[model samples]
Target: MYKISICVISFVFLFFLSVSLFTFSMNFLLNELTYFIEWEVVTLNSSSIVMTFLFDWISLMFMSFVLLISSLVIYYSKEYMAEDYNINRFIMLVLMFIMSMMLLIISPNLISILLGWDGLGLVSYCLVIYFQNVKSYNAGMLTALSNRIGDVALLLAIAWMLNYGGWNFIFYLELMKNDFDMMVIGALVMLAAMTKSAQIPFSSWLPAAMAAPTPVSALVHSSTLVTAGVYLLIRFNCLLENTWLGQFLLLFSGLTMFMAGLGANYEFDLKKIIALSTLSQLGLMMSILSMGFYKLAFFHLLTHALFKALLFMCAGAIIHNMKNSQDIRNMGNLVLQMPLTASCLNLANLALCGMPFLAGFYSKDLILEIVSLSYLNMFSFFLYFFSTGLTVCYSLRLVYYLMTGDFNSSSFMPLNDEGFVMLKGMMGLVIMAIIGGSILSWLIFPVPDMICLPSELKLLTLFVCLLGGISGYLISNVSLMFENKALNYYSMSNFIGTMWFLPIISTLGVINYPLKSGMMILKSFDQGWSEYFGGQMLYNSLKMNSSYNQLFQNNNLKIYLMSFIFWLIILTSLLII
Candidate 1:
C-alpha cells in the first residue's frame, strides 16, 4: 500500500533524464528527440479537430514534477485520511485531478486543452467540497464558477481558431503578429489564463478553495490546478511577447502580487495565509513571464512548487495534530511541541523568503536581479521590491508566531510528531525544497542568464530581506488586528484585509444588484406589458378563433347540418356560375 501511494518511480527516473534531454535538444538538432503525435478525433466541414500531444523536455519535466508532487501528497494523505471511511474515494479524486492535469500539460491542441481544463475545474470542485460542509460547499461553488469563466474563454478561443482550420494553437501562436483574428484569439486565451491563475478580480476563489482537504491543497496549489494557467501562458509566450497585453498582464499581476502579500499579513487562518503566499508567487511568475523572461518564470514556478508543497504538507501535519484547528492564533510556540514539523515549516518559509542556498533563492534572486536590470517604471519597481518585502514580512510573521510565543492552546492536549508516515512523505519534498532550486537552475537553462548590477542595486534585494525580517520579527505577538489597533480604524483595516473588497465586488457586487434588477425585470416584463400584450392578446384571439373552428369538428347534429347545407349551396352556386 505504501509503495502504491508513492507510485512515482518511473517519473523520478525520467525527472533526472529530462535535464540531459533538454540540454541535448536545445543545443543540437541532431539529438532532438522531440515528438509530436496527433490523432484525428473528428472532422467538420473543412476543419480538422485533432487531439495532439507534444513530448518536449518542457512538457515531460513539468509532467514529471507534477506527478512527483501529487504522489507525495497522496502518500501524505494515506496517513492523514487513514481513519476516513471513504479514503478510497479521496485517493481516486486526487488521481483524477492528476490525470486531468497530465492531459493539460501535454496537449498543444486548444480543444484537448479545454477538455483537460474543464476536467480540472470539475474535479477540483469535487475535491474542494469533499468535507460536505456548508463552508466547503460555498468554496466549491466559488471555485467552480470562477473557473467557468476561463472555460468559456477557452471555448471561444477554440471556436474562433476553427476559422483558421486548426485548433492546435502552438502553430498559430508564432504567426499571431498583428493579425486581427489571431489577436482576438490571443486576447481570449490570455483572459482564460488570467482567470485560471487567479489574477486580480478572479483572485477570491483561490483562498476560498483552501476549504479543501490539506492534501488536496498541497497537490492543487503546488503543482497542478493553479500552475495550469502559468503553464499555458508560458506555452503561449510567442503571442504574449509581441502583444500589448503582455504589458497589461504585467500591471495586473504586479498588483496581484502586492495585494496577496498584503492580504496574507492581515489573515489569521493558517491555510489561507499560505494560499495567499501561493497567489503572490503566481503573480511573480506571471509578471516575469509578461516581461519576456519566460525561462525565469519557469524557473521560479518549479522552485515555488517544491517549497510550497512542503509548506502545505507541514501545515497539514500540524493541523491534524491540532485536531484540525487552522487558526494561527490558536497556535503558538509549536516548535516546543512538534519540532520536526516546525523545522520543516520554518525551512519552507525561509525558502519562500528567498533565503540563501535554498530552493527559492536560485530562482527568486535571479528574477529580482533581472527585474532590477530591466527598464521598469518606478511604480513597477516599487511594487516588485515592496511585494518581495511583504512576502518576507508575512512569512517571518508566521514563523515568529509559530516558533516563539507561549503555547496558546490547551496545555493538556498532547502535541507530538509521531506520524512517521506523514514525515516520510514530507521528507521527499523537504530535500527538494532544500536543493531543488539549484538543480532546476542547472537543468532548465544550459546557458544561464548573466546579470551584472551596481553594488547598491544588487544589495537592494538583501536590504528588503533584512527590512522585512526586522518588521516581521518586531510585529506584536497579539496578531495583526489587535496589536496594530485595527479595531480602532476598522473600515481602513477591513478594506485592506479583505483584498480591497474585490471578493465582495466580484462575488456580491456581481450577484446582488443584477439579481435584484432581474427580479424587477421579471415583475415588470414577464408579468406586465409583455405578458398582457403578447400572451393575453394572443390567447384571446386564439381562443375565439378556436371556438369558431371547433363547431365544424364538434360532431354536433346542428353543426353537421349547417356544414352540409353550406357545402351544398356552395356546390350549386359553382355549377350555376
Candidate 2:
C-alpha cells in the first residue's frame, strides 16, 4: 500500500510529462497552443457565469514540473516516512496539493481559479497539521489564515470582474488595462498573489509552515504552493505593467528578498533556513514579475523549482539520519558519513547561489544582469545585490555546519546515506538541477541579444558571488573564536533571527489585540449584560409574575369577577381623564 502511492503518482507524473513535452515540441515547431474548455452554467439578466480552463504551454510546463516533483517527493517519502502509521493519509494530502496546483495553473477564469486557490490553502492546512502535534496545529492555523487573506482578496477581484459582465478575467484584461475599475481589480489580484507568495508582511508563514513533513516541505515550500502567487502575477502581467501597484510590489518584494536572506543567516534550524531561502527566492520571483518580466520570472520559477526541491530532499535525508534533529549546529563533517547526501546538498546549494554554467546561472544570473541594466535607485540596487550575496552567505554557512566543520554530534549517533529510495528521488532532481536552467533558457529565450555594458558591470554577479563566499567562509570560522562576542549581540540576533519581528507582527500584532478586545466584549456583553438583561432577568421577572398570577387565580371566581370589574372601571376612568 505504501509503494502503491508512489506508483500511482509516478504514472500520473509520466502522463503529464509526456503531454508537456509534446506540447512544448509542438509549440516550439509551430506557434503557441492554447486550449480552452468552457461550460456555460447560467445566464441571468444578460450576465453569464461560466467555468473555463485554459491550458497553454506555460500551464502545461508548470504542471509537468509540479507533477514531477510531487512524484519524487512521494517516492522519497517511502524511506523518510516508512515507519509512519498514517503514511497513506500524508500521500493523499500531497496528491491533493498537487491537484490544486494543477488547477491553479490551468484556470484562466477568476471564478474557476478560486477552486484551485482555495484548494491549495485548505490542502496546505491539512498537510501542515499532518503530524497531529500542537506545533503543527498552530503552524497549520497560521498557514491557513494567512492564505485566507489572499482568498478574500481573490473573491474581491471576482466581484470587481462583475463590471465586465462575466467572470472570465483574461478576456477583459486588455480592455480594462487602463480602466480605473481594472486597476482596482489588478491591485486586489496583486495583493492576493502577494499573500500566497508570502511577500513582506505575510512572509512569516512560509518558515512557520515547515512543521509539516520534510517531503511536504519539498513540494509546498520549494515548488508548488509558494510559487502559486508568482504564477498568478505572471498570468496577470499585462494588467500590472507600468502600474503604480506594480512598482509598489517591486519595492516590497525587494525588501522581502533582503529580509528573508538576512533572516536565514541568523537562523539555526535547518528546515527553517531552507524555508527562508525559499521565501527569498519567492521575493526574487515576485520582484521580477512586478517589473513586468513575466517570462523571466516564469523561467526563474521553473529552474528554482528544480534545484530547490533537490535541496529540500537533501535536507530531508540529513534530518532523517540526524534522528529529526533539525538544528544544523548539531550537524558537521557529514561528508565523511553521508557522501551522497552531502554531494547532493552542495550541488543544490551551488545551483541556488547561481554558480556559473549551473541551473541558477542561466536564470538567476540573467535576472541579476537585467536588474543591473535597468535604472535602479540606490535602495533597489542594494536590495538586489545584498540579497544575492546573502544567498551565497547562508548557503556557505549551511555548508560549514553540515559538511566542513569538525564532527560536533555524538560520536555514536547512527547516520548514513544507505536510503537508496531517498537517493533515487534526489538523483532525479540532481540531473535536472544540473541541466534544467541551460535547457530552459535556450528553449524559452532562443534569440540572444548583445549588451553594450562595461565588463565590470557584466561581471558584477560573479563579483558578488565571490564576495558572499568569502564573507560566509570568514564568518563561519571566526565565530568559533568569538563565541561570547556573537552571544553578546543577543538583541540584534533576535531581531534578525525572528525575521525583524515580522512573525510577531503578523501573528501576535495582527491578531492579539483584536482577540483580547473580542474576549472583553464577550465578557461584558454576551456573558454579563446580555445574560442579565435578555435572559436571566427576563426569565426571573416572568417567573415571579407567573407565580403572583397563580396565587391570585387561587381565589374564588366571584372574587375574580369583582376584581375584573373594578379594574375595568379604573381603566375606563383613566381613559376618560
Candidate 3:
C-alpha cells in the first residue's frame, strides 16, 4: 500500500509539474526568455560565493522530460520490485537520483554542479548494488570508479577556473577559446564529459551496470546518469566549438557510436543490448555536439530517453515473464505469449532504428543528415553511416527473435501479458514513443531543420536502413539456426563481441597488475616481515618485561626479602674475609 501511495503521490505531482514545465518551456522559447536566480552567500577577497539556478526552455524541457520519465519509472517499479523487501529503499534512491539530475540540469556553476554530479554517482552506485550480490557489487564498483574519473576531471576544471576568481563556468566558457588556462579548463571539462557519458576508454561501465534492476537501467542509462555529460557539454559548448579538444571529442564519440552498434549485434542479454544502444545514442549525441550542434544533441537526448526507457521497460516485462532470463536466445514466440510487451518492444526497437514518425526518427534522422552535410573527413562519414546501419541491424535482429524466432525456452514456460500494473506504466511511454517525436520536433524547431543534400546523399539514410534491415533479417535466420561460432572466429568475435575486451580492460586490465602488486606487498611486508619484526617483536618484548614485572607486582614480599637477605649475607662474608 505504501508502494502504491509512494508511486501515486510522486507520479501525480511530478507528472503535473512536467506538464506545467513543458507549457512554460514553450512560452519561454517563444519569448526568448531566461531567468537567473542567484543568492550571494558571501564575498571574500574579491571572490563571490553564490548559488545560482538558470531557467530557460532548454533546462526546463530537459527537466520536464526527466521528471516525466522518472515518475513513470517509479510507478513502473511498484510492480517490478513488489516482491523485494527493500523496495522502499529503492524508491528513495530513485527519488534521490531524480533530484540529483534536477540539480545538474539547473546548475551553471561547477561548484554547484558537483552536488548534483556526485549525488548522481553516489545514488547510482546504491541502485546498482541494490541486489547485494557479487555481480552487483562488482558492477557498482565499476560504475562508481568510472564516474569518479569524471569527478576528478571536473574537480580539475574547477581548480583551473579558480584563476578567474569564480567557479561559475557559464561566464567563462567563451573566454576559454582565447586563454590557455581557460582552454585547459575546457579540456578538463571535455574529459569529464567523456567519462560521465561512458565514451571510449570508459564505455564498459554502461553495459556492466545492467547488473542493476531494470527500472534503474531504464532511468540511469536512458536519460539521467549517461546523459549528464552530454548535457554538461551542451551547456559548455561555447568552449568546445572550433577547438582542438572538440575535434578529439568528435573522433572518440564517433568511435563510441560505432563500437556500441557493432557490439549490440553480438550481445545476447536483453538489458545489456539496450544498455549498449544507450551507449550508441550517447555517442550520437556527443558527436553532434562536437560538431557544434548542441540543440540537436539535446533534442535527441530527450527523444532518446522516451523510447529507450520504453525499450527497457518492455525488456523488463519480458524478462519478468521469462523467469528472469535476460538471454535473448532463451526467448522465442514471445509475441504469442506476451503480445503487448512484444509489440511495445518492437515499437521501441523501431524508434531506436530511426523509423519514420517514431520518437527517435525526429532527432536521429536530422542528426545523420546534419552529419552528412558537415565537411567531415571520409573516415568520419563512414563511421556515421555505418553506425546507423548497425543500429538497424541489431534492432532488426531483436525484432525477429522476439516475433518469429523458434521457442527456445522450456516447454512448460507460462509466459503471458497479464501484468496490468506494468502495462499501465508502459502505456504513457507507448504513446510518447509514437507521438513524442512529432510534438518535440514542432516545439524544439519552430520552422524545420531544412537540409539541402544531393539525391544520392539524401537517399543514403533510407538506403542504408533498408540494406541493414534486410541483412539483419537474413542474418538472424542464419545465425540463430546455426551454432554459435564464437570459437571458430575466436579473434574477430572476441574483439567485436566483447566491446573490444573493454569490460576486461576497464575492470581487469586497469586493476589486475596493481591488485597483484598490492597482494604481493601485503604478503611480503605486512604478513611476513612486518608481522615478525614490528608488531610481533614489540609484542614479545612487552610480554617478557611484563612477566618480569609480574613477579614483584603479585605482592611477593617473601621473594623480595629472601633476595635482600642473600645479598646482605654475601656482603658480610666479603667484609670478614
Best by lDDT: 3
lDDT of each: 0.86, 0.87, 0.90
TM-score of each: 0.86, 0.88, 0.90
Q: Measured by TM-score, how close is model 2 to the native structure? A: 0.88
Supply candidate 2's per-residue lDDT for 258: 96
Kindly list the per-residue Cα lDDT of model 1 for residues 1-577, writing each as its tens digit. Answer: 5433333443344345545544444443334467889888788997766678987767877876787787678777778888777877787788789889889988988978998999999999999999999999999999999899999999999899888888877787676656888878878988999889999989999999999999999989989999999999898887777469888899999999999998888888999999999999999999999998888898898889999999999999999998999988889888989999999999999999999999999998999999999988898899899999999999998987787778888878689999997999999889999999887777676587778899999999999989988877765444554654665656655877799898887788889998999999999899989999999889999999998888667879998888899999999999999
Q: Candidate 1: minimum summed lDDT over ten consecutive residues — where? A: 2-11
**Which candidate has the highest TM-score of all?**
3
For all predictions, the C-alpha RMSD in Å is: 7.3, 5.7, 4.5
On lDDT, the stronger of 1 and 2 is: 2
Tens digits of per-residue lDDT for model 2 on 1-577? 6466664566466556745654674473357667888878999999767778887778877877887788788888888888987777777788788888878888988877899999999999998998889999999998999999999999999998888988877888887799999999999999999999999899989999999999999999767889999998898898767889888999999999999998898889999999999999998988888888899999899899989999999999999998899998899999999999999999999999998888988988889888888777878888999999999999999999899767778888998889998999899899999988988887788786455668998888888888988888887788666655765766777888899998899888988999999999999999988999999899999999999888788868887898999999999999999
lDDT of 3 by residue, 96-151 (tens): 99999999999989988989999999999999998899999999999999999999
- Candidate 2: which stretches are off by over 4 Å? 1-30, 40-49, 480-488, 518-577
How does candidate 1 fare on TM-score? 0.86
